[model samples]
Target: MHWNWQQEDWPHFAYNASALRSAEDAFLKGGGIIVGILHHVDVEARQALAIELISQEAVDSSAIEGELLDRASVQSSLARQLGLSADRRKANAAEAGAAELMADLYRSYQAPLSDKLLFDWHAMLMNGRRDLADVGRYRTHADPMQIVSGPLQAPRVHFEAPPSDRVAAEMERFIEWFNATASDAARPLPAITRAGVAHLWFETIHPFEDGNGRLGRAIAEKALAQSLKAPTLTALAETIHRHRKDYYAALHRASQDNRIDDWLAWFADIVTAAQARTTARVRFLIEKTRMLDRLRDQLNPRQEKALLRMFAEGVDGFAGGLSAQNYRTITDAAPATATRDLAGLVEMGALVRSGELRYARYHLALSN
Candidate 1:
């Protein structure tokens, strides 16, 4: 017999609560620290981080679907959604739609989950990509829906969702449980775990033809925001991106089997890791402010831009740390000017240069 959540006989689809106790505690502790950090950061820093985190969530979520979006474009769209100014070009339709819908979901964090909201999100996700065929409405055809890979002739079916006919009812049941979190009833699933459950359950339903994966993740984000009672960006997509294989493997496993303990555990860990990242981000901004104060008088605008790039992008900031060549690229300076700026920065101890002659590279000298 085939397996799926539709065939499961669990109690209200609730899994073992004992399994998540430690995870719940850890998430709460980390979440509280992040919330406090959110309150502590100045509005400018908070908004900047919010812009970056939300852009990550949008871009990374689409990336999980093998869709590469421009980070700058998404950030611009998010800024527009937040009613902030984005000097960058308005994002293309795909980025704009994702940014708009995600912003709506986050802003309306307190609104009850419903079919209309889901449909709207679907529309936003496919606004530009679909352009004409009316994709987000629903999968009207009764064709087979399977996630396949490799050549079409010898396709590997990872999993197949329930028939399109059954999607509506399945989604209704899921939404009921989701909205119930707001009430004072004895909820079967805890608020923290609900995000994971929603993620799994909705993905299983495979409600939309194109944006199920992205929208499912968005739903998880919404549940998370509601649970924490704050819209501080979680950037869960960053974790998902790092563990893309494991993420898909767990989802496929849960789709094939009714037992979801392992799946929920993986998602819980992702949430905890995301919280730690949020904390690190807040502290990073704090450090940058202090560091700039210490070195402000010692650096020029172009040099400062190059220095901040390292802090902003972290590992992806620059491969082998700051270099004369990289600094020139970052600051749009000539080689002679770049060399002079970098040498001056090293003299002021703002950066530490290493390597020999032409091979010399530089890194942040942010040590005591």
Candidate 2:
């Protein structure tokens, strides 16, 4: 079932071209909306910061174990990147850790790097964490690497040491080809196609002792970045994480049969979808910012901070709404001051009182 990967497998699919153009158009339009939203928040400077953090975080998460990094770490890293105090330091750390890994991955392909270079990247991705660290430079000699599972759990042996030096030679040849083919401008390839080739070729080489899947993805992103000549703003890793089962299946299908048209199509579709998803998220965040602005205009500084905190954290920040107790907790106000603030918010139509006095909860008066 092994299909030899060749250039001819790429079909003249006009539809793919149209789809990519449409996706790019939509992305640009969405960018405008993102800008509008940022300006609305009076934080337009934050947009670039946000996009960079998001891109780096995405790359890091993909190269490492998905969901292994916690939310607090992600937030703290983002906060630091944004030059804000990270209330969630743990989340920021996770995101910062991921960004560093992604940066290292991008830097690795300056020249034709070695398998040891990939090993070091994998080590850094898994360093100080639980899942994938110890197997960094080491090679699995006794145990064979199994890429596919279920009935198709085919075991493949990779080289660890000397004597059978053909593996290293083959790997070097592959790396040379990868570096040369990706950079050649005369026969320019689509970013999606390059990503597919990078993934398949890296997996085929199986250069590392472990973390091949992670490294393969990182290499794919590197190729994509090279093709696009811009930092990837889309969350392709998150999209892959969501479709992990299908992702593995697609890779398996590609590996077993070399009709890479389907693989390329799948990769392109994922990229398109990832762009659409991120665009939608940016739009939603923009809308949320508008709502926050409207609410802030009518509230005092302390009340505004309380409202923003609630919006950012949702129900976790305050119990249900700005009750006297909730206000006190959120603004560090005394009980009487908290009561006055709640009453002021209610009078200003920012907070609506629900139920009787004893059981009342103040909720934001959101408009449709």
Candidate 3:
């Protein structure tokens, strides 16, 4: 069976832009809202929002590749990289590398794509790895790069990239197309359309031997950032991770043909959803700051520690809200102390308590 790269049309993708009209409009609208809200927030809140979104993207993108990174470590690394106050905890190589790659993307979104840039990204992603023969470069092996599953003797080939010998030439053409279709290009494609096609095209090429999924997502993000003329901070990878099965299915179906109307529509929904989530995050950060300002110096050390821990859970908050036991665990406070601190928080409007007595759960008063 021929992969999309083997088709006669090859890299020339075809899609109906009209079908994505609503989604495209919604994404742009959401972006505007995010930008406006961010503008009103103070510098500290803005920084916190960026660190949270970027950390989520790094961790989620790696998770899509079956790599479970420590979120706290990634966040700490990003906070340090962005010159914010950071935790004393050290980041491991993988966590540090992901954070570095994400920070670089945020800083260099406006730059044109190039072989050197992609190579540098690959190298950053592969840091501390001793197994790969190729790092910071395209695969040089002669074997066919196939994504497969099931038993080794009876495997199902979901997709196969072009042979290693063709990678250099293929990547050259891909880079040219990417740069040529920039938002400022004479005839640029629509924002979400370009991002969707770029992701599919890059994944079809599967340029690197590893980290292709993560890098492909990054490339898509770059396309969006270029269109917006700023870092997107859209939590795209997190959204995709949440719908990983559908994401893979969409890619598999689109990879078999040049017609990607379905993929574009699906991807547009994903982007718009991610943007909505991001907008919520921006608002959440704003509310968090306001809440802290309102309650500044009102709490004891245990309450302060517990509240900060809950906020670290971000827009999702605690799974079932923060229980008394959970608060005690976070602040190392005794049961009686945890109960008093929680009740005080509720009384102070810092937390909203629900249920009754032993069944009570405390959630942040901020809009989730």
Question: Would you estimate the TM-scores of all the predictions?
Answer: 0.90, 0.62, 0.94
Q: At residue 289, what lDDT does model 3 achieve?
A: 82
lDDT of 1 at 15: 69
Model 1 Cα lDDT, one tens digit per residue, 1-368: 36575575621454687989898788767778877866766888888888888888888898998888898998988898899988777688888988888789779977888988888998888886743344756665587678889997999988888888877777888888888764243464555588888888888778887788998888888887777777747878888888999999888887766677888888888888887777777767766677788898878899889888888775344577776778888899998998899888888877788897789998777532
**Number of the top lDDT candidate:** 3
Clashing pairs in model 1? none
Candidate 2 segments whose C-alpha is farther than 4 A from its true place: 1-67, 75-97, 105-119, 128-142, 148-167, 181-186, 284-295, 300-368
Better of 1 and 3 by lDDT: 3
* Candidates sorted by lDDT, best first: 3, 1, 2
- In terms of TM-score, the best-performing candidate is 3
In order, the Cα lDDT scores of the candidates are 0.79, 0.58, 0.90
Lowest summed lDDT across 10 adjacent residues in model 3 is found at 182-191
- lDDT digits (tens) for residues 140-245 of candidate 3: 8888898999998999999999888898999899888888888788668778998999999999989887999999999999999998888979989999999999
| lDDT of model number 1 | 0.79
The count of backbone overlaps in candidate 3 is 0
User: Which residue pairs of candidate 3 clash?
Assistant: none
